[model samples]
Target: MNLPKPSLRVVFLLAVLVPLIGAFLWLALTSGPLAPVPVTLTTVEMRPVTPTLFGVGTVEARYTYRIGPTYAGRVRRVEVQVGDRVEAGQLLGEMDPVDLDDRVAAADAALRRAESGVVAAHAQVGDAQARRDFAGAQVARYEQLLLSRTASEDTAEAKRQEAQVAEAGLALAVANLESAEQDLVRVRAEREALVQQRANLRLIAPVDALVVSRDAEPGSTVVAGQSVVEVIDPSHLWIDVRFDQLGAGALRADLGARIALRSLPLDTLPGEVLRIEPRSDAVTEEFRAKIAFSTLPEPLPEPLPRLGELAEVTVALEPLEPAPALPNAALHRRDGQLGVWVLDDGGPRFAAVETGARDLEGWVQIRDGLASGDRVILHSRVPLRPGRRVEIVERIPGLPR
Candidate 1:
């Protein structure tokens, strides 16, 4: 059986009507009011929010040791060069013991002379003692002779006088020996002082450290307190961070920090707040904070981060109460109040939010006007406004379901 032919009017109507319907559908899906605006969306939810402060900082040694000479002298030799790793008591440099050596030698000679004088004084005392004994025997014999009327009285008196003279000589010798001993003591002390002064000419490292700089080279003249070599303990390194005073209220000792060394941008060093400086920078209106590494880098990377290296630091403050928080990009300023564009059945609505603490990861706490499971626009390809129709093109990963 042959099918009935369609009329020209039906054909025209079909062609025209179908095209219009197609066009309308295409417009609706692509560019019409019904079309969904491409946007990045996220759901706000309750999460532990840790307030953070971001600041530029510098890596510094907590204690810098400036090794210098104790007195003015010409540097004789330097054992270590700049950037050399040295241990405690390692010889660093030495000053010319120009006159110090001579002084020590003179003190030594003086000590020997004092010792000889003591020996001579002792010998004199011995000689006087023997003489006194002989004189005493003579006096005794003369007295016996006189008792027997065999010795003259004048001879006995002369012998007694001689004994007394010997006794006095012995006392004088003892006094001379004591004086010599004191002179020896004084000379020995002088020698010790000279030796100490000579030892001071040798510069030694006070602790295990990295030699950062060599201020005075060999043969260079340096005055007292003038740095010859600057050393710093590598293990005792810390970062000196300066945060804006306004945002540093919660900063204190022991707070955790994330540090990005300028040289190693990809690696984040874990750190803890060591101290908050009592004084703040008046010019910058910032507070200085000292942060130390939580764990030292193992096998410390070569060309170790030097002192005064620039770094970026983010300090984690106290955790705030759990609240529905959204990405910071989701929030916008509307009439001086912070609000986020919320996706509702009606469309994108301007939801005024009272925000609380914000975290380093860009999450802002929505203290009011938002709840868990509420979708907020993270980013938009087109400008957004209140009551505008929009559909999320993609939901950013890691957002609440």
Candidate 2:
């Protein structure tokens, strides 16, 4: 195809105009009032919001039973080992008898001897009582004979003395019987104490629990109150958490909560506030609280969490309420005012806002000066001013609209 060649003047004019046009376009985009300021925006919305408190905690059993002996002795044998499930009153281990059996036998023998003594005292009392009766009869016969002059005065007097002696003997025998009975009682008490001490040598489970630790082994010497095995009730597990005292006001018994165990990060267990401790940790400047699981995992993970396993707990202090809310990142401080830069018809404008409680998930409640469906500037490439022209590029991810 044939084409006409352009003139030199025309070519020069075209080249000059092209570059000038390009420069003009660049200037208009960079500095013109109509230029668009790239920014990230989030739409404010009203939904349910709940203020929450986060804390690092540990899983603990409310009732931990330490199995040990009441007296110092050598551990004879441990029947239950760590990780073993035990029932209340179940024997876990035993301490060496070490002459305890012998002591018990001796106590039994003493008890029998005391009983025999009582029996002998009773027989003596009976014999003395018979003698007193016979002596009294003889005294009566002598008095009658003396009255009739058939017995001498000296004989009657001797008979009366015999009766008095017999009465004294009977009283002495009765006193001996009481002493023997008291001795029997003392022996019985000693025997009972020995039996109890013997039973103490055996370690017993105080409640249904899983043995978490073994502090003493068979043949190892342990003192009184020294723990041999440690067990905890799985049903009584709870999370012990600490929060800043300033934010602990909302925490109370029966408040709902969520817990994430370090071992099971994928799972969030339902929980409720159990108690707020009266005392706080002075060094940490934290308030102590306990949270219990509302429902354990359907199929609890094998080898349940250890007694002091690390966990994270978030307590829901208040019920969900509808309110104007925005992403926490959208908030900015200018002129000592706590607020956010919102997009109006003009551009990014700073709006002073009163904020209420915020959640752990980075959503802040807008108490005033903002309404639902308002677009707030999340981030801008350059500093923004009131009425500044802006272009919304995208919505920030994970923000509530």
Candidate 3:
């Protein structure tokens, strides 16, 4: 059979394959595959995160008191409502003053009458002194007349008896005057007490605080010493974070803390540890850590720390031990092996990894195949081969998650 030997088309095809096969053989002998240039990737991780402890507590007013009156009386008018800021000596509410006002007036009138009595007593004293002098002089005159016999003995004796009677009357008048003076003093004291009662009827705030709760409404019959309103000083707000005794030693006063409030989840307020209670709370049986905000965060629409609200406090610490860490995105599982994509001089390389701990900070500590400050890919779409080529681009700014 005559096969068309080696046509021009067949020759051209053979010619192309001959060199291509040789080149392929040459590449296999030299290197199996060309090395991939290392990719530059940025990653974030925490070195061996030493164990840290945190505490959760409630915010409260440093000075919380239930104010009431010393004496019980019906409330007539309430001057404040819940959430009102009050200053020291600011009037809060008024009690019914009908009875108190009447008592004050009566006491004042009695005081006035007593003063009049004092004047009358002074007059009586003067009169008594004059009578006493006259009586004494009459006795002297009687004695002299008796001795001279210028006056009859019976007449002198009668004058002596009359002078004795006048002296007794004068002493009685002086005693009456002293008694009236004392009565005046007592009446004046009662008037002072009445004045105090009148003042008490007008209830006033005992300290600077914000009113929290108002138990007494307008026209509500609130007795003295009853709670008209509950007030708290926002400036004096503090947090009590209870921690176990195990975590107490690390927590010192004035330590920097980050607090997450339940009300405002988006924001965190910076605070300092005010103090740590040496003794654990009796009810909670946990060590209490007190913290106060440096300043209320600006742009906050309302008070971030509400009284009696649950809050979480995290005590930040420097790592005692450091382990190689990388961003979680660089890790993958293959054939029951946890592997990470590490960029080397030959681009992205797959290496087995041993992970130790993971923190909420998105950092995973690696026990193997990574070092601190090593750059790794954050996120990659394609599967990583041992010697795959890759290109890295710096992260763009202002990108949405």
Highest TM-score model number: 2
lDDT of 1 by residue, 279-396 (tens): 9999999999898988886666678777888999999889988888888888898888879887777588788989888887888888889889888788876678776777666553
Ranking by TM-score: 2, 1, 3
Show pairs that collide, candidate 3.
37-347, 38-347, 48-323, 68-225, 69-225, 72-224, 73-224
- Residue 205, candidate 3: how far off, in angstroms? 1.9
Model 1, which residues run further than 4 Å from truth?
1-30, 38-44, 124-171, 343-345, 371-381, 392-401
TM-score (C-alpha, index-matched) for candidate 2: 0.83
Over 4 Å off, model 2: 1-49, 297-301, 319-329, 333-337, 360-363, 367-387, 391-401
Off by over 4 Å in 3: 1-53, 250-258, 265-270, 278-285, 295-304, 315-401
Candidate 3 per-residue C-alpha lDDT over 257-350 given as tens digits, one digit per residue, 9 for 90 to 100: 8888888767788888898887887676678878887677444336436788988887754454766677666678878888877777856766
The local lDDT score (0 to 100) that residue 17 gets in candidate 2 is: 100
TM-score of each: 0.80, 0.83, 0.63
Whole-model lDDT values for every prediction: 0.87, 0.87, 0.74
